[model samples]
Target: MSETTDPDLDDSVRIADPSIDTDVIDRIESALEEGALADGPEVRAFESEFGAYCRTDHAVATSNGTTALHAALEALDVEDGDAVITTPFSFVASANAIRLAGATPVFADIDLETYTLDPADVERVLAERDDVVGLLPVHLYGLAADVSALCELADEHDLFVLEDACQAHGAAVRGDRVGGFGDAACFSFYPTKNMTTGEGGIVTTDREDVAERVASYVNHGRAENGTGDYDHVRLGHNYRMTALAAAIGRSQLERLPEFNERRRENAAYYDDRLADLPLETPTEPDGYRHVYHQYTIRTDDRDALADGLAARNVDAAIYYETPIHRQSAYETVSTAAAELPRAQRAAETVLSVPVHPALSERDRRVVVEEICDYFHNQ
Candidate 1:
């Protein structure tokens, strides 16, 4: 990181959002001309490398993150009316994917400190509906969900475990990577994510059938066999990744580990400097390696604090103002049966500070000082 300058005195304490634009104008153009721009060898290469990185036996590339989640559900054969338990404190795709897969998304309250699905709440849901076919635990803000305990509970209930590791690329729990923690893990390569493929995703798993189903499903059900060249093996989707997107992703993947490391360093600086404030810094458990995708903290006076930061040209904002279960899109959901005091409170108070790899030391210091000033004035 760079050194901090006073808001009134310095010129470039401003932080730039980190992400690489697809500079392969030539590659994309050439591929488009050649008509080999669809899900070709480039996508295959990305999937193969990504699978190895995740320590999974197979990886299926998809058109986007949501498709990746839907494919995972379909691969597991999640049925209509079957409940797929997950956290409401995450991106809408977590629950929307379940609904799209013909299952009801059973939302559980999140742990206040980690903003992940609370295991106890999961147990509560399971106690009532033991027919849950899958559990999609999201590793929010690059912090690993309590996978060990969650897996234990899933095993107890005989439910399949899937990981929504979209925001947690390169993040690990107890030395095991997020993709390896569940029966299958889904990753997003969206532009704002820690890493990107321009626009694509990868689904990792160890099961042969699941991998095959995912491959066929994403490519118009083309089985890797002879006869009926356009044969449809299973009810499938045209969710294949393009070669151009995969090419960009290949470059991005090479840089992801270092990018995550920089995020961790910025988080450590915030953790040390913001300790005296009313906010609670994100916690990285002893065995968990948090990549600090957003470096979020909670303040009782969130709006005032956010305004203060904005006045200084520091862009801090709330990630989720409403839990998924409480959203108008899901108001009819039954997951809100019990009071979600934790999720509601987190929604009110939590705000994310910039923690992208592009931050300079000066940028980080300014952020910390402005936050400190917010507390002192209170």
Candidate 2:
């Protein structure tokens, strides 16, 4: 088996580093001492701080990004028989969350350059289906989706828009942060993401109704202003974030801007170094801030290039070798047969290298040199 397939056989440059320093440890210890481990003061503080950072009126913390997405969908009242239009070129979680909310995910193509939802294809999807009540656009690889255009299209159709900012913690579209673009946005704090919350996520929204619904949905559907603690008014799940995770998230949130800047710097270095190569580097259009979650590039010879990088002990992985609609889990979905040529082509050609903040100068140099040498030898 190839090193990429066999984890134990791989010894390459680190792709991500979720290192927790003494500050994070101290926060966790403090949270533990507080004796409120489940959705207490720490979680509330993190939500408030994150909301302020996103420039949104409300932010609700959840156990993970998937749950965040689901909570946001439920808060929007998207349920059985309703359909949502979204790009298929993303992690399965994007689609799974739609399904978990009792809605079907309608497939759309992506912009080949940004690898995000194509508003034109979204319009085509909307024209074909009247059941698409919402639009879910994933900010793939830390680049903000064209939320402005998507939201405009949604407005014409009177549909709600939800942003999947799981990979784009600090990314912005037209100078405004991603989380405030649509009706609501979801963010992931996975260790590999721009920020680490020790496994947590949050939903940001300007609407108080959406915020209140999401908060209730994630906490066993407890009534926000009920008579007692067990007053469950609606169906919900136990997707609340722990105090420890919230504590860590608070510290990470404080450093997210710095971390994203380093990632952008590393991506710029790659862009300059790999300019003359045979591949197409990432694209950051005017007014859009790309946080460089994965510094992905596109090459027709993607498989051979990935193998070459592995041989040199450098890490290069496919972000989504299979688009969501093509996955076995979505085989039975009607959108599986949708003709998303751009998304399908991206699945075959896209490759993501190390662009994390943890990468050193030498590490970046090594990655560039290996790729240049690979092309030279060919």
Candidate 3:
């Protein structure tokens, strides 16, 4: 049997390294001292800073990435029976958000090299179905999706664009940041991301209506112009980011550029070091800046490689071993236009080695050496 199917194989090296230093604690303390620990100044400030970073007019903070996606879909008016075109090879949250917003998620294949939603497949799906109300594309593995093409499709089809930039904090396409390209883009501030807020997310957009709607959706549908009173103006949920999380998020956000640069340097090193190996390294197409959330490689012997790396204490992860359409929860609502062969192939063979900013040079060498040894032994 191929190593890709091995059940016991696992990545030994952990991928993320989120540092919470004294500065974060100081901010948290300030929030506590001011008695504004919940959805107060810190979250507001984080939103503004993050908005500026993304070059968006406004940003709405949420409790987590999934909530941000749900809120964005809600703002786009995704409702029951409405379909959203999205890549099948992504974290389940991308599709779950569509379902949570009362929409059906139609699966599209990916551009294997970029591992993003394929524009041709998306256009085909949109042309065939009139119920597709939005294009939900994921910037998978810190590489920006083809939002430029997706936007064109959206304009032609009269559909909204919601970018799932949960893993693409510093990524950009054609010199524009990923978050501001779509109608609304969702970001994850989980510890595993380029930056961390312990647990949080944000929605960035240029549209005031979308910004206002998402802001309202996350805070229990309360009107924007209201006191700290509980007034249920519309159906909403308590998806507000905590002041504590926001405080930490601010510190991490401030350090994001530096962190992303380190990640890039590490990825470059891997590119040179692993060049001779019998595997396909990550790709960064022209006009796109990849943040290297996980430096994934494709190989037929993925499971064996991962197992070998794990045996040597090197953690390699398979970002999405199962495509969204194949998951049981989505079996009923999800429909693929045709066979998503590229996405299927990716699910079976892709493996992510550590490319976090925290990795030392020795750690990088160990990762490459283990994989090299694995293939050598085989």
Candidate 4:
């Protein structure tokens, strides 16, 4: 889509990248020395900071993003036979979490441009289904979904909204952050996400009941901390975030905006250069902000392009080579038989390039040039 590479540049340029700061290392070293690595002060500090960032009243740190989502579903009291509508184009965790929480996941197609769940499609699914709890639209590739319309549908259906915001830590739709739009939001702090805690996740909620439910759900259903050591309120899992992970998360959260900005800057460079290409690049939906987590693009000849990039020693990835609904696990429950054309198209044509924050101007140029060259040869 774009080409601005220097002839002398190397093959290390990528589509997305993660930003790392020495300050994070320093924070980790200090935490380890002070034994502040598990559910410690640093962990508490990160939960507070993350909650504040998401404009929520509470944030519960969990072992992983999947647990964060599970906690939300638990908090909402989702049970067997309850249905949750979600896009099939997202990470399997989105639907998997629903299935794990004893809920049925209804598949929905995504908006072609934003690659997020389509509200129209969501409504159609809801209209034709029953016992639907709510929508769990993912902010795919750091782009926000059509939350306003989805929220309207939820209001009309009297359903709960639990967002799978793991890959969209700082993304916004309609001028509102992903976490702020839903009843509860889940985020992953994996190393590759916009931010990292080494490994952890957080759940945000405005409702005290939901917050308390998730808090208890994460810690073996303990009703009180020091009141009764053996008291168990409800069934729970050991999905707690370790202190070390929280320590790193605290540092990373503070630097999130800067990291997101770097991603945006790199994406801006590609947007300017790839305007003339035959490939279809990502687009920010109306009134939404894209954080460019993967900087994915779609080309009719994705396999050829990927092979070409590989031949040049550049790294390009095919994200979700198979749509989740098409997977064997979902086949029995899936009402549609690989019927999502856009999802299937994206699965075949989409390619993830490095878009991490560690990229330099020279690196961006090389990546763009390699992609442009592949298309030109085709």
Candidate 5:
């Protein structure tokens, strides 16, 4: 693992470590040697392997998570004046993607316990709105959102469901992976994510139409079965994944199971050690496999706790200090922004410490010790 530490933190324990082992290097080297740097066979193979991993029939590779999301929304035909119900308590990208697709993102309160979209609130939004055309639930911090219930609601309301599974690559609910739950799901391979491809993303789905549309959209709207390479069909963007990123992604995918297991183990250790502490540890609902992209804890004194860790040279960070709806950009875009009290509270309290797969025993111990010392001393 090529572990990176922050010099400003004085070699502190990292919140995440993107493992670029020899396998990834070798794959990239091979691609470089063959001059296969463009969107080609490597991307195709990665898509195939990733689709199989996610239990989906097709996976459309893209330049990054944001593009994957935009492409998916476009494929669903969510356009101007259409509103999509989504959680406000995630990385802004979740809602930003909807806005980028020329649609309005309607805010819904989250279930504070899970830090994910609350189906009840979603239903309420659906009840009050006539413009809602889709559901975009984010699997925040590697916990699978209650997609099953959300999907059922979508069925009743005749709305499309697209999961923002960017933080939940390997997470599952009741033995089934997240990508297959909704109409389509998106995964990110950003450096800090559970896995890394330098930078890349993919859309996983069983629907052939969605897959086809995403593929074309990512490739400048070129017709799949067009007579010529330059034949344009619909207006699209250059969101295609490069061969180098795909090569790294394929290698990372092979190691994802092991990486996720280590994260789970570290989280389990935190759960046991932090049980009696003042802060609230993360929860894994029954039969759900939480991949622990961020082992976040909630406490009213979140800032103090984070400061304490930083002073001790232990890296701790906030995943989303500001909920999407509260951002300056979304202030006017979403009408329900002020209605998400749970999301507002979560933004002020949640702090994620070092729980990446690459953390050493000493690193994890320091994290737990510093956190415990902070509360105990207080």
Candidate 6:
């Protein structure tokens, strides 16, 4: 947690680090040594290992996180003209994937504490709308959403639950992994994520049917599970993860626990140091293990805080400065019946500081000192 053990933190404090090392290099070399570099042994091994880690029966790899979600929604039978309920506080891709699946994203406000979909708000919306066929709750900033409540709502309304676990690779709730909660959960392996495959995604599920559907849809809609080439059963996309990326992913996946633990340590440090400050620190609800992808803090003067941190060489970032409904791309199809005050307030007030594993003790102290100086001196 400090520079004594992590010497590289002094170099620079970034929001995230890929943590690539000799192991990743060796895996890439091994993948190249083999004659197969396409969706071959490495991809299969990654899927199997990742699925096992998440306690899911099947894990389907894709080109990226967005495709994973799009495929998940489609595999769950979210048809055209259907509406999917989701929070407006997440990354744009969360809502965009619903659109890619030919469904309208119904925006709901988020809970102030978790920055996730408000279950009560969701239930209120469901009671009023009949077209909502699914619930797509994002585990934003690496915290598990209220999947238990969302799952209950889904069961009560016969709706599908597809967790957006892109930022929450190893996060859990009540001792269960976030990826294992919903019908199918999507994970991102982008370089900035908790784990990286250069650029990759996966769909984890216990349902054999969902696994089979996502597998086929991601591979040109051909019949999967050893089906011969040119046997196209349905229209699909070529969203396959390369063997090289898969190899990197497997190596990263192996180190995910360590990475998440280091992130937690960093987050705890920030929480303790910044407790008395006017800004609100991140929260880990009861029984939820939050893998801190971004240690986001909320303050009314977020711009000033970000500016001050940057001026002092501390990298601070704002995730989603604009909500999805406010974004121009979603203005056409996105619907909002009730006021999304929490989401809007969060967009205006939140700022993420460096909490990545690579941060050094010196870097941590610099961030803490700078943030305190900004508030106390003013």
- The better candidate by lDDT, 4 or 6, is 6
Q: Is 2 or 3 the stronger prediction by TM-score?
A: 2
Superior candidate under lDDT, 1 versus 5: 5
lDDT of 4: 0.82
Global fold similarity of model 6 (TM-score): 0.96
lDDT of 1: 0.84
Between candidates 3 and 4, the one scoring higher on lDDT is 3
- Residue 107 in candidate 6, Cα distance off native in Å: 0.9
Highest-TM-score candidate: 5
In order of appearance, the predictions have TM-scores of 0.92, 0.96, 0.95, 0.93, 0.97, 0.96
Candidate 3: tens digits of C-alpha lDDT, residues 1-378: 011212236434557666666787788889888787778887899999999999999999999999999998998888898988999999999999998998888998999999999999898777788888889999999999888888998998888899999999989988888899888999999888999888999999999999998988898899985429887688988899999999888888888999899999999998998898889999999999999998999999999888888888877789899898888786566483348999999999999999988776667888878888887877
Q: What is the per-residue lDDT of model 4 for residues 53-135, given as tens digits with 9 covering 90 to 100?
A: 99999998999999999888989999998989988898889989999999888888888888888898888787888879888
Off by over 4 Å in 1: 1-16, 21-35, 225-228
Give, for candidate 2, the lowest lDDT window spanning 10 residues.
1-10
The digit string of per-residue lDDT tens for model 1 on 128-237 reads: 88668878999999998999989999888889998999999989977788897788889998877888776888899998888888888888777854113778778888
lDDT of 5 at 327: 83
lDDT of 6: 0.89
Judging by TM-score, tell me the better candidate of 2 and 4. 2
Give the clash count for model 4.
Answer: 18
Computed on alpha carbons, the lDDT of every model, listed in order, comes to 0.84, 0.90, 0.88, 0.82, 0.90, 0.89
| Candidate 3 TM-score versus the reference | 0.95
Report the C-alpha lDDT of model 6 over 1-378, residue by residue, as the tens digit: 112224444445666656786777778889999857768888999999999999999999998999999988888888887999998889899999998888999988899889999999999889889899999999999999999999999999999899999999999998899888889999999888998888999999999999999999988898986434788888888888899999999888888999999999999999999999998999999999999998999999999889998887677888889888888886676474447899999999999998888877788999999999999999
Q: Which parts of model 3 have CA positions greater than 4 angstroms off?
A: 1-13, 334-338
